[model samples]
Target: MPASTSKSPRVAVLADSDTRWKWGALTAHRLVPGGRLDGHLLRGRATPTPRQLGEVDEAGVRPDSVTEVTAAEFLATMARERYDVVVLALVGGGVQAMLHGLTHAWRGRERRPVVVTGYVGVVYEKVTDGLLLRHGADLVLANSRRDAERFRAVYEGVGVDASAVVEVALPFLGGAPYRPADPYTVVFAAQPSVPAGRADRAYLLERLVRHARRHPDREVLLKLRSRPGEHTTHVEELPYQKLVRGLRPPANFRLVYGHMGEVLDRADLLVTVSSTAALEALHRGVPTAVLTDLGVREALGNHHFVGSGCLVSWDQIDAGRVPVADPRWTQRNGVAPGDAYGTAFDAARGRIAALLGGAGPGVIAPYYDARTAPGYVPGLLARYHLGVDGVPLAGAPRADRPSGPVRQVVRRAARGAYRHGVQRVAPVVRRLGEL
Candidate 1:
């Protein structure tokens, strides 16, 4: 890389792994010219996926564009190369690390644009690029406007610049529309986070099987979604035999694994708890029932039956006969399908464009339509504690001491320890080897 006196907006994106690197590379290729695109992947020991390798090969992005390095390594590169913008796609603890480093680097130089994608599962509450922006993220592109607004609301007191919050529709949501035969068929969508119904999921599966058995003539469907390598991890634990043993399963009780668009075609009702699949079902004019707890009910508000009908609790399903598809929900939420879709799309795009430093008319265009994400973060955090997938604590937890100075000292000390731990370990290990 040489210092040329030019005004082109060159960007350096930080990816977590090769697969992430490929996505960043492709996005840059579409948005920025070749010479302006620079992609750096975090130096993780994880092996590159086949699809990732394939994407890299097809894209023909040079090896120079995709270097493996630590956050510090990439930060040094950004400083040396002088990137105009930085797009960070890493999630979880990686998100915090990127924010810390970028904040430090930005403090010393001219302000550079910082945009991050927030698509991780809702398990980690209050942890997002939304949180990063508080540290100094120029823009945080949420998957939807509802999410973007929620981000703004969540960080209201934190003092992050609100203008930089945008919501863009996720690339995966570009699925085909779903239309059922008579709006009477029902589909139970499966999520990766095993539903917390009954002590054992097998018991719940048995209950669902019994429901299918009772309604032998009605169409019953089960659609499951998991990541590329998660099939084996999730499936082996599921009780397939007991759940499907006795009765001849209904014609609609099909096991859907991938590509939700195809399975949603004949589904009149979609059932799930806290899965974004419900949003997909809503977009496709299918009624949805979130059969979990009251928390989900509270987050989504009362209109469960929009394009679809919603039943909050499993007991409500039996009492209300939700799979039957209530007509009121359909009429209210799905009155004018095309017009509604266009409006939702427009709202999402406008919010996203505004966050990304763009303006009104162009932001609301069809190509940038962002859909709302049906996620409840507070509930997720309540269910899953912070230690495993959250910010690492120093000597003592933050909750133990709420005083400003105490908390700040812990955070600063933790950061210092993390930064120097690798250096400290090298010498002691070398001395032990001599012994």
Candidate 2:
């Protein structure tokens, strides 16, 4: 904790139940040990699994500190306690809870100190107003500096007054075990496809399997980490391992579960089709190939590892291998290029404290959508009129028009040829020996 003259400020950390609490909470503790940091687990759609519940129950938060609260309860807790700071380190879907807390403030008697913090990517900038700025977000924190800069650019471009955002890096384990030298290992962490990233995954995985077939002796290992509640719509429809089973690669495939860190520890080459796991592998001195280029080239730019190889496409995988020991494999310590995994919560707390001159913490009330009353479609639509809620909405748009006749014909021919090629290689994927 920073040396304080008076009693340390009490900080309440909002943690989501779906994620691991240790990393976020531990980091908060490093910032404030006696600061009354509490973890509030955001309830998910399903009942918490045994492991999920166990992780929460085992966090050892004091009875007063540990509470399973809904989005409504979060603002109530803030109002009742009027905490000095609220650190929000929630998962992808928990932003609503933060909005609820803000709504509570909007409706209630007091404002709560709050920091809006999370790992949400640029995709969320649409639904959230001013990316939580207009709703009392004072400071925004992200996972990397790059993301922070991106957030700032996007936020300011739309007139958000960017001074409120800060990017604090997660403490990545750099000296963690390195891959064993020699006998280069191709490593990839399999994510059950999600509709959002599935097309890229299928395209990249197909190309990877095709490449591996040419060098049957090369050792490649694909690992999948499964925990309950980690749902993907596509995975719910078609599980990943089933697809892996379909890819019966010859001599170079091993499927394993759990112990991902251990598995990556021995990998000399790491490949990710835009998975954050690539970052983890990179930290382990494994050369990372960020496969961000697919059909959606214009929508998303290539993700380049700083000082490393250019963002690679599936066709370039073979020629793109770089040595893990090269200087390009090294990255700066602390935050890379994104906003804090926990942005609004930390900002709310820190900025509120700043605004209040370290007096009573600023209070952030709850924000709610009337349930009994019909969903406020008009009220929601009004936000679009004001120009905040619909930012990210434009990123992924619907293309209703069918492909032009010529393009459709070309696509059909390409699909036929691609299917023929895949059929020719389908037998190859079916055997560990053929690869």
Candidate 3:
């Protein structure tokens, strides 16, 4: 355990959105085994609102402090605090940029924080591309045994070190087995970008309305990730909340917000097009279904559940059909049986201990650099206002944290504008340009 060191190791988790923060914060506790932690929310289009962070924050593992910062400001903090571990709970581009950024930030230093990065959910798309961008982390977490194997294939194929990929279950899985509440409740876990088209989202909403009408004795909850003007890990072009505006559903049907775990407390059945919530439900033995109503396409992401035996349609469910997930499938995909979760993080902890236990921390460079990826790497770093050398570009404004009530209002307004641009402006502009 940490080589019996006198000083408790420090950890920093830099997350971009609400869901990532939930995964990352819990992961930090598991990695260090006994160290307190701090959080950094990257200033971006998808930064979590106060309510979002509040819902994800756990009792014991909540960071002692949380700071909002941009790419440049984060680099400065890393150098100043000298944390023992830094978790890059970000998108692939953010991780890649931060890898280079940290290399420069820790240059010539004897010790550097052991960097960790990984996906928060099922890796259905961009398998190789995502793996490559996340290559340099000292621990790249794979949420299942299957995930670890696939990760090795991609890295070993490209002559990159695959040892960093560690097998660990999703850190957010903890809930009692499903027990029926007074009224059977079915929750449709909505994703921000699963069905990107308005018509598709509306269709799903309409079907849920039909279900609520047909089963008046049942409670149907449409679990949403964000409110109207807020954002999540992905851009939501057509949010289910927006699509439900024109629907007249039964009184038993409603929209819910808060922790998915808390919602699962009363849920007898959970449904989703393609959400990490499906895994959470299965972990708790809640009856879960991966909807094939919209066709199990890769774009829809239900294809990842092809052999899970939990794939069924709204029509079948309407006919009182229940999909029983194959037990073997669940075990292979990191959905360990109930009560077996405590061991899931042990492997990750041992790996971190070995790194932080031995000689002073070492610096690891990313796969991409100015020379190896001349056409690509520079532009990616520039998006974060960082140069190819991983230093702040000249004239980049300082990203000091904003405070005071007036500034808080301004921050919310800015977030609203950014969401409008992503959901409303960018799509129209793209369509027009194509024409």
Candidate 4:
């Protein structure tokens, strides 16, 4: 990689889902002000659809180009592109697999691009395992002061280098400060799988409808991430849309979908189970709540908001109680009231700049190698259609495809079928097995 291109630095982001793509694309623009940014979306079960991309691209991060690639195909494209920076906005396993695969593919290269990886939102589970899985990159972005501290502890505790951890805030956290729209709006940022059961999801919807009835003067909006046939970052077994079918609500209550920030424009209160939208709402100074009615459990992720003072029950919310976030908690978690968020990415930008201007960073050395992760590594890479040798499997797609309309349609149909199986067929089959 002795600088194949002579102009501005090249940045390529490899993303898996819509949320990661939004974070990665926005991060690229933040890291390199004018650098050419291209995107690679891994072909998978959760690959962002055209509609989903359009939803998040409102941040003005529509990439110069977006291509679909498998793990081996991405590596092959990396060999030819000679990018200045590569961002891995993927799940933990995907990041680890790509790190090892890239290490092998770029062996003995004259120079290598700086690699980056990080989480999309609050890290509420599998702290050690997830951090170590994303261990090997030039920089592993920590989205808050607390996250940075935890990340450092995990790396040092395991005898790994902790210098790569850099503090940064969520990239998509900018919008007009809350001005309080007329009629006083309430928006519930729905989660796909936080509750992960039809009973819980339906109960929540019933509560929302009841709330609308309780306060007819105030407008209530259910902000959904995707429709019935679509997939998002998480597997939505029971969409709120499906649950709302059996309930009749007042005209004042409605379901809406678009950019989260746009909906925040009219919101006087933001409520969620544990979606990242709560942080976004806090960034824009909207009154926010993390529901505790389901119990403050790690499984629901509401426990992460315990000290934030945003936790409240729907019973409390309906009783005219407004939740206020703790300032110390907000600052610690990177919500940083006022001008602090404007500088959240300053450190990240400077770090990337130094790496680009100075000597190249060393090779990508993931924590899990064949010897270290003998029981797990092979299967993980195999799912991406990569062999134990880190080469493309015989039947795997080996090149990045700017897919045509027909291919796109077929891909959509295949994904719809997979989601249907997860949501419908599997549960019945399991029940039958039990009987």
TM-scores, all models, native as reference: 0.53, 0.61, 0.95, 0.95
How do the residues 1-435 of candidate 2 rate in per-residue lDDT, one tens digit apiece? Answer: 222223666666666533334345644553444576667754433222345444333444332356554454555565556555556665433444355434444454444454545452223224344344223345555545555666677666655466656655443333354646555677766654332244455665666677677657677776664442343211232335545557777677666554445667678767665445566665555666766555323233223343455355555667645634233233332223223233423543455546546443344322223442125422442332211131212322222333357854664465455544433454455555746
- Candidate 1 deviant stretches above 4 angstroms: 1-85, 103-113, 120-124, 127-135, 143-146, 169-171, 182-185, 194-200, 216-221, 227-252, 293-309, 313-435
The CA lDDT at 317 in model 3 is: 89
lDDT of each: 0.47, 0.48, 0.86, 0.86
Model 4 C-alpha lDDT per residue in residues 139-212, reported as the tens digit of each score: 89998999999999999998889999999998888889988888989999998988987678888999999999
Candidate 2, residue 124: lDDT: 24
Which predicted model would earn the best TM-score? Answer: 4
Q: Which tens-of-lDDT digit does each residue in 1-435 have in candidate 3?
A: 442223777788999998888889988877776776889999878888888888756324667789888888899888766677889999999999999888888888876778899999999999998998998999999999999999999999988789999999998888778888879898999999989887788888898889999999999999999988888898998777767876878899999988889999999889999899999999989999999989989998899898999999999988888778899999999888876687888888888778777884566767778877899999999988889998989866474645568976877788889888888898798889979
As a TM-score, model 4 comes out at 0.95
Candidate numbers, best lDDT first, in rank order: 4, 3, 2, 1
Separate clash counts for every candidate: 5, 68, 0, 0
